[model samples]
Target: MKLRKWAMGLLAAGLLTAGLSAGSPREAYAESKQIEVSFSPVHFIFGGEELDPPEGQRAFLYKDSTYVPLRFASYALGKAVDWDPDTYTVTVREPKAEEKVSIDAYIEERKAGDRPILPVDASALQPITIDAYFEKVNYVFGKRTVQPPAELPGIIIDGSLYVPLRFVSESAGNKLEWDGETYAITGVSTAEGAKPYDEIVLEAEQAFQELVSGFTSEFYVLKSEYDGADDAGREEVLLQGARKLLEGQETFRSEILETLKAKLKAGNYYEGAVDQLAAQFEDKKQGVINLVTLFTGKDLTPYLEKAEKELEGK
Candidate 1:
């Protein structure tokens, strides 16, 4: 395949150049450093005009710039690339021959019609070599702009470029399920799993409601006392309400902590978990202030004044 040839050629060129270099062979080798390859000029079109390959890939234009790794391009084209390591070769096969169309043609056709061209959906494909696919796509679509570490384990398999499953799955709004015996992921959501994403958002909203409810109840009790509505009786009510509200806040915090702990124990630290927690905390604090204002029927100037000190102690 043209793509595979280009990859092999680049590899061969690097090896050959390194072998012939005199001093500082690593520094002497040019392509040893990361380089870019562009698909736009070679294959992409926008507004009926050919888009240029990105600058980095253009530098390598002298040496088969059009070549793309068969596996990577095939996957991008929504085809599957099967490899036989024993035979040291790859086989590119489309799911259905009736779907035979180059990526450029596919995109152009979509652009000409009412429908938008969605990314190739490869969720159903079986696992293959992720590394090979990664290298191919990274070299092609990535324009070779970044250099993946050479010694990473596992090949980019299936149609989805295999990344750290934890990061990719969570980002894609999917959960990772681990089977101890086989270590396979079975519960991955396809692109169509908008419901899971919606559920997560809804749960977040409910959590905020719980946090605000307690704060609102406490604020009303505090205001009644400030307004001179039987100080002694109101004090007793305020203290009880404050205690309950504080407990509610603590419970919410505990829920967040428990979720984090579970993720950590499961060996999946989601990237956004910390940020989400912090945002929730801030939202709860603001809710408390808003509730206080509503209860007092006046500006919460005194409480806001002491907020900094209270936060410092916290």
Candidate 2:
């Protein structure tokens, strides 16, 4: 099939949409309270490891309470944060462990268009405004509406919401301690028998990389054979090589999935991590499809479909 036919299928599935919707605009505020606060050089340690806040974002001190960027802190600690402009509410939730992915990676992917990562210089004490009209804005953790103590009310700086450190840590079911002398804040997850998330991801990713390396070596050998073949002989070489490649693809995919599931059963893997493996697998599959198309001048989709049916029948 032509590529446009595939795109039409995507449209029928609602997998494609027109230009993205611009969300509701924030309400204008006439009454506002301006207050001065000092940005402190406070370090953050989460799950026993220190996380460097994105450059230009800092923890600030106000009324003896320390405030950090709302989305940054929540995300680093494996929580989800969302803002609803229509209701002026910020909701943070501890998504189930199995559903949790590395939010840090997700943030990096969307950093270019996100708000919290926007450029700012919060190196010293600066004046910030609290719009009276936004006083009724809600902060929710799970299903509970969080009413921060008057001494530590939420503040906005440079278009980013800032919430008290203690509030964020405890809400995410983590314990927090401040080292006044060192200007460091350490947060430890309070969940019993919680696995080390970063360590698990590192181990799984290393194994996946090794698999890809081996597959790449085999792929190059097949490419060499195909290139050296004459026009008439190329089809036979491609067909024979494609069988081995497809078999290896299925085998590697099954092995990697099994390993990932084992880790998940041990409470150490997030389901979303599987996407990394799937993406790499699909890239290799597409490369094989492209090579077939280049040599035969025909759509490989039907051949791939026939191969699928054969494999299924077997």
Candidate 3:
């Protein structure tokens, strides 16, 4: 997507239209477009996959606000959902132990490596709040208005607003914690994060560069092994190293997501170039992975899946 057009189009088409605060910067277009209601095409993506709502629960724009069915969201995220009879409340809970994939061994293994291995700062990624009914004030105005984080936008139940905790954040692997005292959802996130835009661009660039370099080095070794292997040994060593590289590639991608989040901070009008660069970086990396798989003609996916599951808890 063209960064500038995508930003403005979404913002202008009801996803944005932010209201100005009492004493904030006033731009003519922003002021005129406030409360502009327009229909938008929306989709909810979790675990790097897009989800579909049950039959009639398609996402739609109304009153300059986006809305989605609560039940549909919970089901898509693997989160448990319930409704209260008297209190008129809908409840959701995140899985206790969601990902079985372990990061410890990877960390320990990296300690002996030359350059310092930078673990993604999970604390930095903010949770995107979902709601049954949204008050435009929270999402609009000078606040990060570019992207509203409306995966399953707010829905209204009997005039009260509620946000479902399903699919917290795929990019950050965010989790929700219930506070017994306040009865609110909160907790530690297991995803990457960035500080400000400038810092994010710098961090993202560094992380991406390192990942590419690592992939290049591993690819060279894999190619070398493939060239030298006899037919009898080709499937053995060649496929094994290829599988390992794919698994490690996932780790690198996750590590870089935080930097991308910061680099793609919503509502920052001066970041079109950064946005374009980030998207291009993703395409290039994916192209390399595709080529690796195509050249090998070996389905190394099963290995990645097995490692992601059985290798955990070891």
RMSD of each: 18.6, 20.0, 20.5
The TM-score of predicted model 3 comes to 0.31
lDDT of 2 at 127: 51
lDDT of each: 0.38, 0.58, 0.41
Which order, best to worst by TM-score? 2, 1, 3
Cα lDDT tens digits, model 1, 57-111, are 2211111223322322333334433443223223333345544444445434333
Per-residue lDDT of candidate 2, residues 81-183 (tens digit): 6666566577777656643665756445423332132223454436553321113447776665656776676665444456787877654445567776656
Which candidate number would show the highest lDDT if scored against the true structure?
Answer: 2
Name the lDDT of candidate 1: 0.38
For candidate 3, the per-residue lDDT at 51 reads 49
lDDT ranking, high to low = 2, 3, 1
TM-score of each: 0.32, 0.44, 0.31
Estimate the TM-score for candidate 2. 0.44
Poorest 10 consecutive residues by lDDT, candidate 1: 20-29
In terms of TM-score, the best-performing candidate is 2
TM-score of the candidate numbered 1? 0.32
Worst 10 residues of 2 by lDDT: 13-22
Clash pairs (backbone) in predicted model 3: 18-141, 130-163, 131-154, 131-163, 132-155, 132-162, 146-267, 177-186, 192-258
In candidate 3, position 243 carries an lDDT of: 60
